[model samples]
Target chain A: MSPRDLAIKDLKTHDLTMREAARASSGARVDLLLIAEMVRPGSRVLDIGSGDGELLELLATTRGCDARGIELSREGVNAGVARGLAVIQGDADIDLADYPDNAFDYVILSQTIQATRRPKWVLEQMLRVGSRAIVSFPNFGFWRMRLDLLVNGKMPSTENLPYRWHDTPNIHFCTIRDFVDLVDEVGAGIERAVALDASGHPVRFNLPWAVWNLLGEQAVFLLSRKG
Target chain B: MSDSDTTSGEIRAFEPARGEADHPHSAVLRFGADMPLQLDAGGVLTPFQIAYQTYGTLNAARSNAILICHALSGDQHVANVHPVTGKPGWWETLVGPGKPIDTDRYFVIGTNVVGGCMGSTGPSSLNPATGAPYGLDLPILTIRDMVRAQAMLVDHLGIERLLAVVGGSMGGMQVLQWAASYPERVFAAFPIATAARHSAQNIAFHEVGRQAIMADPEWRAGRYLADASSPRRGLAVARMAAHITYMSDSSLHRKFGRRLQDREGRTFSFDADFQVESYLRYQGEAFVDRFDANSYLYMTRAMDYFDLAADYGGVLANAFKATKTRFCLVSFTSDWLFTTADSRNIVHALNAAGAPVSFAEIESDKGHDAFLLDEPEFFAITRGFIDAAARAVGVN
Candidate 1:
């Protein structure tokens, strides 16, 4: 097993609760836990493009949040529903408009914004439907990816983004600095931001956007609408 | 030979059939003069009977009860051997021991609608005042009327609040009606391949079937029982036409195509030259054996009269205003009869009402009838929603 699995096994052996074991085990995706941590307990949440409902399950089971999901694929929606989560088969770009304004306390898009056709519009919709929004995505400007592109003369393929250039669903990829600029353009206030390195460890940067863009492989942000 | 038999010798095709109205395989609930059912089409029905079949055990809290509503042609024998056809029940694919419905965990109840022929007070039953078949005399029933009678049955069973109400097609309409009329009484609803109201195109199809049945000389002006004749051919043709609408072009192409029925090549006379024609002939022939012609007219008319949004000041969301009932609406991608747009309309209304709802448009070429078949994704959602709802309500 991987080192993460061994640590989770050790946590389970030490009689941690299922939620703790789950949180400790890295069972839910790393970025999903980060999003879940940002949500207040017992808040209403909607997860767009919630593949298999891993984050919804985390929010509901651990935080007692009223979690719901929208998935684009029939297979993904059915899989989420089979796991006892309330999810609908719908497109993130189209179906998000159906939900009323301020319907949820927190609207989340984790590791999925890059795949969205209109990232700014989706971010605006998330803020419209929820009092707060949480978004996480792989940063395209990590040093290793830049190095690979410079030396190998090929499109960057790092640990966080392993997809081939042609078949990748990440059509609108952005660097950390680029996302921060887009967030500002959409009149959003970033209340909290975390930059994580390759090993799922937060870089703990109080530095500039350029430094975070070059160092962090992934980024998560908690935002609210600015008047 | 008896005088009645001799008089109607040529029309002996009926089953002699409406016999189930009295001697049915289900548990019958009879209403006396004290319990008159008020219908939406402007009158009341008295001394009626509701035939229903039950599976599993009602929990001590009665919170495990699930009421299953049958479609236009279905009856209460939802998960048993049909008494007339001697075949498996209509929804046997979804409801049985260890099935997705899981009889071991749910007290599932399937009831024949108020206008249905199978042991229910329908057009085929005897008129208590006249001692002849009610026929057209039975007050017109609506989807609301069907659900109203079902509410009575639920009350009779001592279930104040049902854990869930589920169905497909016309049955799904009734499920929506339940959500609207008795919102507090239902905890969850599973409506598959359904809509809030019957579409204009659907009404047109039903009209075609109605005309076919009415045009038959054997109909005797809807008093066929009094004339001792049944419109077998007309009813069969009606079923055949409606059956075509229930399937998609792709599925039809896959199942029957332009292939010959048997014999290598076609004899090409006015015979069953193609396999599809032969198959339709079989369907129509088998349908007339078990269904009542007059009941067909009543069921179709009820569907045509359904318009829930019109009743609520032209707003569909108003019908479900502040409803606590959890809803899961599903549609098939190829169901032209009740397309995915219909399901989305309901989803939008529920979203407007701020009700908890989930919707899915499953990919299948089997058309509207896909809900009745063994589709893995459909079954998984069904089982999961029920399981999760059970946990929410604290049902063991």
Candidate 2:
């Protein structure tokens, strides 16, 4: 079996103690694991575009956090709700404004920033509603994507960004550098950042922002509003 | 389980009735002088009776009881066969054994409101003070008064708190009233396709229906029952007009369109040429058979007077201040009568009051009747909300 399949199999067999330890340490995708580590135990969380509520479920079961989620698809909301998580069917672009300021400790938009109509406004709203926001997205400026465009003269489609241009939901795709510039423009500070390779493992630490942007297949950033 | 297992002290087993008119599953509980229902219209309703039906079994702790409020024309016939029409219950789509308001697990109760045409005490019920029907003499009832009567019924059933109060349309209005008036008594509330107050357009339509009923020569100023006569034509017209409001334009067009009724082409006369007209006539005729004109007026008026925020100094959030009851508000996109904005307004107020709330706007073309239809999304959301609330109340 593949390593991903093996990790999932191990997670299923482990009891609560082992499951909690595996979740707190590392088990699944590196970005999600990193996001889980940044969240404090027992804090309130709101996961926007929380497809199937995997992160919300993890936070609730492992960290004992009060987790809520807003998903765009009815099926995802139904699945999340059936698992006893407080998830509602709503659009991130429209429903985010309804939440009160500072309502959650952490607001997460994992792997969904590029699909938003107004990514900057959504990030700003996330910062307004949460003390800290965590965002993850596929890096469009990866070296392989750059090379594929240069050699083949076409939009690159990799495992992380696997959709064709016509059917892709990732409108307004941005690189890590572009996202950093947006964070600066929105008056938010990046508290921490992680660049994950193609195999869902973080790249070497202490790399400059430019090198990380070019090499990272995907990126996760922990952001907070600048006073 | 057998019938005996389903029977409890609060609910009797369903025994076959002697006559066709009697509801085998219904129980009529009377509130005499000792328990007078104080109305919002400054009148006391004494010696009144509430007709209700129970399904499933109420556990020993009674934390599994769910109270369902009926809409304007709905009665206590929620999940069983309707006695009068001999058809399935109104909410059978969502209240059967394995449905959203699952009768297999939780005990479900549906009550006829105070001012309803059903077995409940209303304008048709003879007043104890006089040897005649109350008619107009029956004090104009409000939504709060109906909820108050239900609370009394709940008290009589020995249930201190309801696991959830649920309903749609005017029924939903009663659910909100239950949450607002007896916040501590409701563990959860699901108010679907209803507004905090009746919109002016709704009141206008209701006024038109009321005018139609009163204009009939046989009405006799709401005393047709005493005169041994009925305003059947006027009531049917009123029903026909109101039925159009219950559906969306697309639904009507899809169901009837401009198709000729029982013919390839129209006769060109003023007869029921279109299928829509024939359908409305059938609805009107069917409605007049089971509904009373005076009771219809009273029910619509009750809905018109429902304004939770106005009662709480015009601030909707004040109505839900410190409420521990979890709420799930639902609205349909095609329900123009009670738009999604109304449910959102309620959600905002509940949020501002620090109440745990969830809202869903289901995409439907069925209009206000969407709540009563077999909408899968609505069913899933309802089941999820009820299951979560049941878990919180320790109902397994």
Candidate 3:
């Protein structure tokens, strides 16, 4: 049984709320121990906005990993198939360009790549189904969200940017050096980054990388594939 | 099962009645009958005693052991003091110290299983080579002889490996028989609400509570504690038919369905005209004032011969083939006697035994006693599956 155990057995069958289905489909709140140590224990994940599976039940409980999410929210794929997990809801910018490539050993995408309208064709269909992907977000050059949009210019309510820039869906806001120059303009290679800060913690990595490359509030990357 | 003991010279000799002195958090651990729990009918159970309670401090690398397992007439008092009804350890809601099984970070342990009578050893002790009591000579026990007497109490506490092994009903059948009988001696396994098998309507509601404790007559055959004759009304009608399978006919239609028990009308004949029959007659007269009617018929036939895929060959992922031991398996959508299709058949036999399983069902109207209550979404799916199996077994 593999399409990654039939996509985690259709994500155990979808009941939703990994925190509000990963904040109504990736607005964030996952970190389940750095996604169970970047999905290793028995690898083969894929997630990409999998809500209510809480990062596929924290990579099937701390990396005995064998996930399979996808999600757009059918109530977060029926609460991640009532906790038997193995999601699928669909529409990761046109159903993750129909799978089949590396097939997955990572893929993730937390906080839904700023509510994609095609964030680089859903990061090129999460780098064509996996050999590592990850991503995360919410940086937008943080320093208190660029001092609340350069002092009182609106849009940046805090507590991990709680909406209201005219009903915010956060149309792709970037940062950590514009997402490391969009993963070096699509070639892909980072292999780990992290960040966090604002009450979420993490940050330290021997400072002076220009004040955490402009006030890190939340980032996470991890990429792969290029070389 | 016949051997009445017949008031052997007017019985009543085993004592221990002080007062106000059973509360070092909770204690009652008499090893008694010189530690004899060897029985599978070849019989040899000298005297008996096992009312336990322990929490924290076993570590100097005794790999922070943990074992809770208590259900049909639970005992050992896991997180603290419960010396016979002084109350306070029926899994004091997911066990103490910052909960989620933290007892200040592990070394827990809880006894009372070999056909329980609060303390272990069972059939109401005493039989040192038959000087009396081993009612039907103890013997019969099975959740793998209660995990081979909790692996002989984790080899009397030298503890090799066990950072986790929790339980829920029949203490999740001894945490799925300690991850299918010592899969590398259990690293983590939760097993709430339970069911690796035990249906046929929960062994026909445990054969109507072991035929209402062998139809009482102060249950003489199993020697009703030799002669003070204690089948407390057929063990309070077998704890009121196993407390109506621990609730959820919509929690007895939202706690006490047919209402009226404190005088509303129906001075009605057979008495208790409702209020869930005076709350199942106060949960079967506070469960026969703290259990034992042949240790609730040998702990409901060791949770009716628990299944763990009928001991491997029938494949519940071949009892977790080639294990790494990480499973979670919870279920509650009003627990229809261990439902959600028995935790999706133990997550499809731990995904057809490739192992490494995790599952949840939650929702809850608190049936199958929602793992014993206050469920913050079943405590955030058990703190997100033990903080992702304690960050994948690094365990800090």
Candidate 4:
């Protein structure tokens, strides 16, 4: 695969929408399955940056949920529609504000949050449209990412962050701690959290936030607005 | 052998210039005064007929039937050779034996709308009472009335639910009407290059076309048939003007580029100097032969009065509330007539109504006419959406 495809693939293991190329590959993606688990069966769902609608299809068929998506590229939107899914061409930064509040039961932003220009605004919009928001991202503070940056004194690039420093689509890279802080600042609370190691397995079940932030290469969270 | 059967005194069979009464390629279903059609214009049409053509075979389950609606000037000959012009079907690029809308798999039915001048009942059809053409006396038709007429035909064919309804432009309006009027009967709708309501600019253009036809002395207040005259020039000019909106500036530039028509130098006269001018004249002349002046007036008026949202208490979403039909709307970048923004507005309303909908604004410079051309991306979307909807409805 090309570097761009590699970056998107690396991003997809956590974000169901970014897994454009990996959408056709064998078994269910671990992170997408994880996000799907947090969603209540038969609930309405809105998947942001839903590239080609692989996860939306999974949600609709497996959970019997009314699933829809907002994608940025027309190519992705058309492809998703071809699969007989309700996906429209829209941007995460702009179009979310147009949706009515509480329209969906769950609003999901998978591996794609890191690529957004305003993660905080997008999180708030997702929360506004849905009662619950599920987000997953690659943890920038992972041991390997940290070691590579600290020792090489260069921008860290790994399996999770495959793009070179210049061409990376990730504009707002955030560690698990950084994301948690943003969630709190946005007046939301994490209802459930799972940190995954490099191989996509849950890491250090009983460990503290700091330990999980360092060891976990990626993370998924279920969030809700504060009462 | 003559298409003049519909014009003869005391004639019962009404057909277009290119359609002969004995042609086996199409069929017409007649509904007498007992089975009257309710019109949106607070009038009723009796003793009407719907002309249609069927392609492929109907499956035993009756679930494989697809209805393909035609645009303003199109007729029932969707995938067959035109009996008049001897040209391939207007949508020859999309619907054929092995095309995206595969005739080998699905039974496709194309209908000449009620207000159309084809073999269908329209202003051109002879009035049974007067023994003369209906002309302006025929009750004004709307998109909904056309759909109701189609519903009767579907009932006549013994199909309770259609597998899908597809069209572009004016036909797209009919598709929207189908989804809104009888949501349960339509499994899927593919409306391309259309808007929920006619734009003001479109109304203005239609007005120009109407005025041109009415201005002609030959038109004789839409009683040209009684006067034994045809408003050929007036109708041709109207067609010439409307045809400009169907193509893009870039396409026009590329196709003609201010080039002279069959001459190296200007003639210094009004005789078709430019290639574009020559092309538009040919289009106008060709249209006049196949279309009726009075039918053109009613068709444009119906389009101008169409406002889907107005009927649903001022909310477009209300028109599609709880609709189970799957929808796929396609638009082209260069289509300024009915733009991508128009398609988006419909998509937004569908989303608000919780309808399963997909929208694609294909990249093309072919303007509004792109939907009728060989667009591969559009073909793929049509094939994919139909195939998927087919599976959902267990058509196979």
Chain B vs. true chain B: TM-score for each candidate?
0.96, 0.94, 0.36, 0.94
Between candidates 2 and 4, name the one with more favorable TM-score.
4
DockQ for each model: 0.49, 0.28, 0.05, 0.55
Report the C-alpha lDDT of model 1 over B235-347, residue by residue, as the tens digit. Answer: 99999999999999999999998998877886869999899999999999888887888889999988888888998998999999999888888999999999899999899
Look at candidate 3 and tell me the lDDT of residue B55.
79
Residue-level lDDT of model 1, residues A1-227, one tens digit each, is: 22233334333322323355455796766667767877899999999988888898889988999888899987787777776677888888888888889989999998899999989899999999898999999998988889999999999887667889999999999999899889889998887777777876666545666877888899888889887
Better of 3 and 4 by TM-score: 4
Report residue B61 deviation for candidate 1 (angstroms): 1.8
Could you tell me every candidate's TM-score relative to the true structure? 0.92, 0.89, 0.37, 0.91
Q: B242-354, model 2: which lDDT tens digit per residue?
A: 98999999999899889989887869799999999999999988887778788889999999888889999999888999998888888999999899999988887876676
* Candidate 1, superposed: residue stretches over 4 Å from native: A1-26, B1-15
Candidate 2, residues A48-158: lDDT per residue as tens digits? 987777888788877888788888887787767666666666788988898888888999999999999999899999999898999999998889999999999999988
Clashes of 4: 1
Candidate 4, position A53, lDDT: 87
Off by over 4 Å in 4: A1-26, B1-25
Per-residue lDDT of model 3, residues B259-362, tens digit only: 88878688848988888888888888777766667878887887887777867677677777778877766777888888877776676566555465555566
Ranking by DockQ: 4, 1, 2, 3
Question: Residue-wise lDDT of candidate 4 within B144-253, one digit each (tens)?
Answer: 99999999989888898999999999999999999999999999999999999999999999999999999999889888775567788899999999999999999899
Q: Report lDDT (CA) for all predictions.
A: 0.85, 0.82, 0.68, 0.84
Give a tens-digit lDDT track for model 3, residues A39-114: 5688878787787777777677656777867666545655664565555445678757656567677888887798
Candidate order by lDDT, decreasing, is 1, 4, 2, 3
User: Which candidate has the highest lDDT of all?
Assistant: 1
